[model samples]
Target chain A: MNSSASTKERILTAAEALFAQRGFEGASLRQLTAAAGVNLAAVNYHFGSKDHLVEQVFKRRLDQLNARRLGALKHIAGLQETTLEDVLSAFIRPALDLSHDGGGGLFMRVLARAFAEHDDSLRKFLSENYGHVMRQFTVEFARLLPGLSKEELYWRIDLVTGALTHAMSGFGIIQRKSDVSETSHREQTAEHLIRFAAAGLRAP
Target chain B: MNSSASTKERILTAAEALFAQRGFEGASLRQLTAAAGVNLAAVNYHFGSKDHLVEQVFKRRLDQLNARRLGALKHIAGLQETTLEDVLSAFIRPALDLSHDGGGGLFMRVLARAFAEHDDSLRKFLSENYGHVMRQFTVEFARLLPGLSKEELYWRIDLVTGALTHAMSGFGIIQRKSDVSETSHREQTAEHLIRFAAAGLRAP
Candidate 1:
């Protein structure tokens, strides 16, 4: 990578950790710059402003996460034999994989903070950029659960999203045991989430 | 009410709003006291320090919320006739009701922040102070399901909690129509959560 590109990558990496640890508001520019080993000019040169940097932090992970989710959904979206669990796995496995990947779990913590932040600009940015990914998943979910009204489907999906977000944020009690391999632990986590989400989505 | 008592209430109310609007770390003491229309000394006199103030903020709401949860759980915990839905209702309705109650929803937002914050001291405080409520509910949930192993049961409960916390934090897309009464909306929310959670916990 070029020097400029590596500089940008360093800032993004440090920003992700600081933001996850100290929140968007709490993480100061000075601290972020110091952590990244970059100067103020470097940040300004790259991302223009802290707000824009935050957006990039989200875009970096979410773009990949949602793309994988959409890629998975395409295979079974409207298939007659696709079970609810299949649709759920497509939606969930990517997130679980992301969380287990190096530093991806920290990104999930940042995402959770964004949800809690309730910042209007961030919300709008997410909705505008990634809303279609969710809409596509909703369509697949609708195909499998023909009994639910649109409102009901939205409610269930929102709840499932909440559960997944919470779990991915790593705040819950279910920790991976030291004895378990990373891949094994990820698979176990996926199974638990998929089963629970599938049943929740199918609830009468 | 007495002057000191009302002062404390004012601080808590303001703290909840500021914490929700910004965050635990983002909301400064100056802002908190200013919003409360009080001085630094008053906060010090009333709560000693910001950390204690945060604890009091949680204690004020959690005490009432968990009391109601336990009260509801007591009515139908282990009875053979109690359906999974009943146990789920006992656990969920109180939270939904709390979220609709005055300023309680803001507290949920704060709770979400705490989860995201992942502060060790705060986590310990919550576990030590209110852990019993969750334990009681878990016992009842185990009795009702009887099929899930302890580890599996804990995993599912954690997911259900994540979903409920996410929904109650008011970040999800689900919104009440203007025509709907607050009570009606809350009832609808409770129904959706209990049904989803019941099915989730009962998943094979």
Candidate 2:
């Protein structure tokens, strides 16, 4: 974080790195505050609790990521000319782009942890707030693929999400070549993901 | 567990359940022993330490799962008429079938956790021991679809594994209906996964 960044920004930045490394349950507030260069009272004053801080860490990125996705979707949704590939790009690009943001890459690992942790309260929090973004995308997917039953679409969407989470968390067998710049690699990832996801979504 | 089951079997069974619920770091030997209805000495005796026990828990299930996957792949390797979907079924079916085994459902969550954890030592262990299964499958895939480059094949396989891990962990929105029996639900999941994956692997 820049020196000008506030106490709240510093805390969230440190929390994302710690949570990515040590997981939410594993990372203590003392370690978190110490890493942030802030004291315990400052933490309490900024985020209310560790639980609240975790949510803020997620909200900071997800809010922008989802917003970009929805904005992209808004351009293509219900257009007769819109292709499956286009709809997929709207969904996949924003998430992959997050990996390039300064120190924002670890946030993907944090998101992957949320999926694996099976923490009931955290999931409920996600579903209640950001679930609508997915719901909207599914509606658009339904429009383009009229033959698929709602159940089938959900299966595809859920699996596609799995692949995205799995790959975006940097667990894939493929690695970026040293010669390729990060931006170039991100675009290739988007292209590869969009093609595979579009094909999976349109499977007979 | 049955009284006839050995102490090693009992400890392994209980360990898988605890590790599934709480992660490797989160679950303790004491809680694991208490759950298994065995003494602490049994844990030390059966598996030297918590880390070794964790590896054993993985090996017990993964050894079986990979053997089954490779066995299926071997049958179709040089067949004159096997379709891409057939090759995929060989890979996907056995992993999904694990869910139907007694107390085996939670193991998928554990596997999913392993992916998200990003622990270097554990990943190297998986790649060293189990990576060959995927490598063999990839060679078969390459012969069948000569159009895709090696890099492309790896990317799709990685994503498909992600989707498979994501879906099999019961994290998807699609759930078994009340009318669907365990056998029927499992079958449907296999169908959905194989179809989606085959399409994904063969994407243009």
Candidate 3:
């Protein structure tokens, strides 16, 4: 990466980590600049303001994440008969993959904090930017479960999203000990979640 | 109510509202005291610290809520063959009823924020103090679905909790315009959530 591009990425990485650690209200610009090893002016020059900086951190991951979700959905739609498992995979695999990506786990943590805290501006930004991705899933889900009312479909989708988000945040009550490999645990988690979610979606 | 008892209740009520609005990190002791119409010392006197205060706020409603959940579960267990509907109602009714309770919605919002925003202290507090209630539900859930493995049961329960928490937080994407009556909308939401959750649970 070029010097300027590298600096910008560093700032974002630092900002996301600090924000996830201390939250938007608790994180200071000075701390962010210090962690990024960049001058304070760089943050202003690149992101304009702290609020804008926070927004960028989310958008960086969310934009790509949503695209992957949409792509997965589209691929599933093209199949002759999209079973419940296909639909579940499309909705879930991107999120699970993101969790394993470098720094992607931090991004998921940030997203969870934003959603859980209902930080107003962040929530609005997400709705405006990523709401359509969710809507697309909702439409697909409605089709998958033709018997469900629109209201019922929305409710289940809401739950599914919440569960996925929670799992992504890595805050499950059950934690594996140090002896367990992280990769294996994540794989097991993914399999269990997909199966459990599929059963929920296919329930009569 | 006694003066001290009333004061404690007032602080909790105020804390829940501020916490819901500004989140655990965002809402300060000063803000909490001001909202409660009490002095700073009252907070220290009543709850020892902010972390303790947050735990107390949750404890206040959680005991009653869990009682209701266990009560519902007990009713369901009395039947030889429990339907998906029965299992779902046992799980969801307490949460929905809490949401409908006067000022209960605010508490739900606060609880949602707490889970979304990860502070190690709060997480530890919840796991220590409130984890047993979750375990209680999990035990009942295991009995209902004897066919699933231990890992599978936990995953579904985790998702179910996540979805229910998200719904309670009022982050539902489908916003009802001013044209819809609030009562009608709430009823609609509860009915839809119960049905969706029930269907998902029943799916093989």
Docking class of 2: medium
| Candidate 1 residue lDDT tens string, B48-127 | 98899999999989998899989888777546588878878888888887776877778888888888887789999888
Enumerate residue pairs that collide in model 1: none
lDDT of 3 by residue, A3-97 (tens): 99999999999998998888888789999999999998999998888889989998998887988989999998898998777777887778877
Q: For this target, which candidate reaches the highest DockQ against the unseen true structure?
A: 1
Cα deviation at B93, candidate 2, in Å, is 0.8
TM-score of 3: 0.88
List the candidate 3 regions with Cα displacement exceeding 4 Å: A174-187, B75-84, B174-191
Score candidate 1 by DockQ. Answer: 0.84
Cα-lDDT of candidate 3 = 0.79
Enumerate residue pairs that collide in model 2. none
Ten contiguous residues minimizing lDDT sum, candidate 3 chain B: B195-204
By DockQ, the better pick of 1 and 3 is 1
Put the candidates in TM-score order, highest first.
1, 2, 3
* Model 3 clashing residue pairs (backbone): A200-B200, A203-B203
DockQ of each: 0.84, 0.76, 0.54
Task: List runs of model 2 lying over 4 Å from the truth.
Answer: A1-5, A78-80, B1-5
